[model samples]
Target: MTASPSAARGLAARLADGPVICAEGYLFELERRGYLQAGAFVPEVVLEHPERVTALHEEFVHAGSDVVEAFTYYTHREKLRVIGAVDLLEPLNREALALASRVAADTGTLLAGNICNTNVYDPADPASADRARAMFTEQVGWAAEAGVDYVIGETFGFLGEALVALEVVREAGLPAVITMNLHEAPRTREGTELPEAMRRLADAGASVVGLNCGRGPATMLPLLAELVDAVPVPVAALPVPYRTDAAHPHFQALVDEAYPGLPSGRPFPTALDPFTCNRYEIADFARAATDAGAHYLGLCCGAAPHHVRAMAEALGRTPPASRYSEDMSRHVYFGSDPTLARLNLEYGRTL
Candidate 1:
């Protein structure tokens, strides 16, 4: 199915129909594919390897993503300057948005322009706010010109910064999905409570407001429960697909005493293999998130195509990817069919 530019439904219209599955975690997924850098986290691949970006977007859409978000997570000017690639800033943003637009049109998915934490906001220094706003405005302008269905401002650690992002999206006259990222404190960096922070974003005209990144499903759900009751706007919850607990509420804070010889003294970016959640855990999270009143559901950071498929299935929808979903009953040793080899079936227990 194809949705022409005039035929595409907006983000709000889609949410009214049913749950919206947005596939994020492009940074981690592309890094794993050897097309991106982790520490820098810049999506230069959008310009360097357009096919790689296009393929990933197609994979996510086939896996049942309702939205095809542009890979502009860290494509802001600040991140580009950090790596001395500021020259590629505008080109990268335009390319990413163009790539996402094609996929969304082809797959009949909502296309979202993305702006994330600027890493430049500081309450003490008022100049920081201007810098952050400028970055958001430029990126959002490109998105508006590209004709995205909406804009998403995510992974903010401060209500103040998130408000700035919301302001930019509203200025563009596009629907806004604002999501915060909580640290171990369960509060914004400026010390406002999570629920209150979401209230502020919603009041500022965010179409959907809630939490993303930082915490895992276990840690993020309790927070989402608060937002659902406190904020009137639709709530969004996209947790990192990791087993984060109260003791280690955020994946970055997760430790592995089993491997003490680590390079960063933590298991965050590259070393979180042991902490990754399986498909079942992701399915469980999807069910729990809906129960908690979060209508905008997705996986962050460590998400994979299988995890997205599991989320879609948990929501009672089978995407194109479901055609390949596991059927262990058909295995040589696990099959119960009369045609199965009895010798291999009996050998399964002893072996």
Candidate 2:
């Protein structure tokens, strides 16, 4: 069967002429905003706050986001079962997609159905892969049926599992974007490098590939550079706020270890004090990612409306276009000052 017209405008097509912005947040954020009562990790926020969902959609659009992902991350049956809503999986997933589609239709922006990590990461068991594949297939199929423009499997920690999610989206005849989470060096917890991961996902039929939810932009760049060289498709980079306090050694250690040939026994660097970066920091990161070759840029966890606006402004000034394209050259900006690299390296070995 032919794909839907909206779906036909694949993520690559939509992002080809220029940069595309995507907002990332799970159902928990919606609940925090009083739009939901918190049933599961991916509760039915849309059912209760369709307007709020719509409002966020409108805000992103106003801020110049080209795509808004539906809040369906962790909406799979196994995840819902943890919260006693096992029976509501299909309905809830469908509803989330529908709500996103409605917002997209009303605002002329693309809607991407968000599918996140599986119930658990169990590489030793083939059953885990099987279950993940099945869940992803069902969820992607439902998203397609509900008329999403595309499907995004995000915050993935394992390449094996990410490939399973990619397969399901392809079988459903929808374009897919796989965004994985990584430690300081852009490797999975098991040490699969970001470049290798991106290559594998592209081979598995992911139309767009990127990173999300692990570390902020400061720590994400090394991996983003590797990804630009690894994949032929457009790369999207959505960095979230730092997961730990700025002074936390664990966070700093990740940054230190991600660079090539870093010593394993180096002393850890002192953590940088925390400071409010506001939209300026976000804009700087987006610009850096774009300069480093990210074709699609946006915000993730802890990112607010202003951050998205800053990204849009950065893109607007640099590209002067609104559609996605592949001919664009990836830009890289490495400064003479090595403060970031030095600090990151100092922390990299601590992990």
Candidate 3:
């Protein structure tokens, strides 16, 4: 009466293959909700309004998210050092994972540890790569210890950084997903082609790979199609809010007038008036992603719970009920700084 191993794996694959709705980054979503003022990163705001982190996760779960990413995207030790919270990295990472886990357990969803870019892009310097690798390994280890089911490396602009992150997640023995932010040309920031990036990430040991946090879906469809043809693993698309060329100046002035203490010095772009995309547009994006070989569909910035619901309805399936464990190690690799040869060896044995 027991299911075969292949059958079980098949079921797990199906569940993991479906759409994975996203809640926007903690700081961005909270700012939109008016829970936190603009111009601050999640870690800084977490120190003052920690509960907002938990609330954001809960909201996404209620909105039918199959997976809820931990709010630790910017909690890396190096970034924390810049913010004078170097000592708080461990606590914040652990707390963020624990909070996401707790909410996932309660809502029957999965938790993905959010591993973001190092926020330091210096192509001329090899040291930046070393530092980025170190930070990624440390954060992935912490996520493993804190019990995250998968490490979701989101918003990476460069393929090299994504490779480093994939290596770290592989070494930690965890499922890993990589989302690249697309430029106007549909290439990564480093100028690597999307198809090439897909091949490299799959070879580097990523379970899921796709595009997220770029220009709106309208601009991302062709890129998604290219990615679909390049990788055998499940793909995903998470587009952010559109940029309004006409109103950007006005919005920047309004944000400056409203929040003079903004840290990044970049003027706030006008918030999409929530009507940027209607249900039909949202459904069309989801349908295109699904048709283009993106098994996982969701929204990034400017996407709300209504979008999630609409996408789910478009797919004609409810969110999966199984919860994801941080320790599963379904398709992971481990080591401090493993070379590609070593990664290939590790991957071969796992297969």
Q: Which one is best on TM-score?
A: 1
The positional error of residue 170 in candidate 2, measured at the CA in angstroms, is: 0.9
Clashing pairs in 3: 148-326, 149-325, 149-326, 170-333, 171-333, 171-334
Best by lDDT: 1
Q: Candidate 1: what lDDT?
A: 0.90
Estimate every model's Cα lDDT from 0 to 1.
0.90, 0.69, 0.68
Q: What's the TM for model 1? A: 0.97
**For model 3, how does the per-residue alpha-carbon lDDT over 1-351 read when each residue is reduced to its tens digit?**
121122323313645656556556456666676665443364655556668778777766665677767778778877787767688887788777777777766765666788888877556678898999888887888788766677889888888888888998989988888888765465777788889988899888888898877557666665777787899877878876443232231222223345545564544433445326676687788887888878766777666666666666677755332132122333345332344357655776666
Tell me the spans in candidate 3 whose CA falls farther than 4 Å from its real position. Answer: 1-17, 243-270, 318-351
Q: Give per-residue CA lDDT, model 2, range 209-256, as digits (tens).
A: 998765676667656777898899889788764433333313334433
Scored against the true structure, residue 284 in model 2 reaches a CA lDDT of 80
Give the winner by lDDT: 2 or 3. Answer: 2
lDDT of 2 at 124: 82
In candidate 2, what residue range of length 10 has the lowest lDDT sum? 267-276
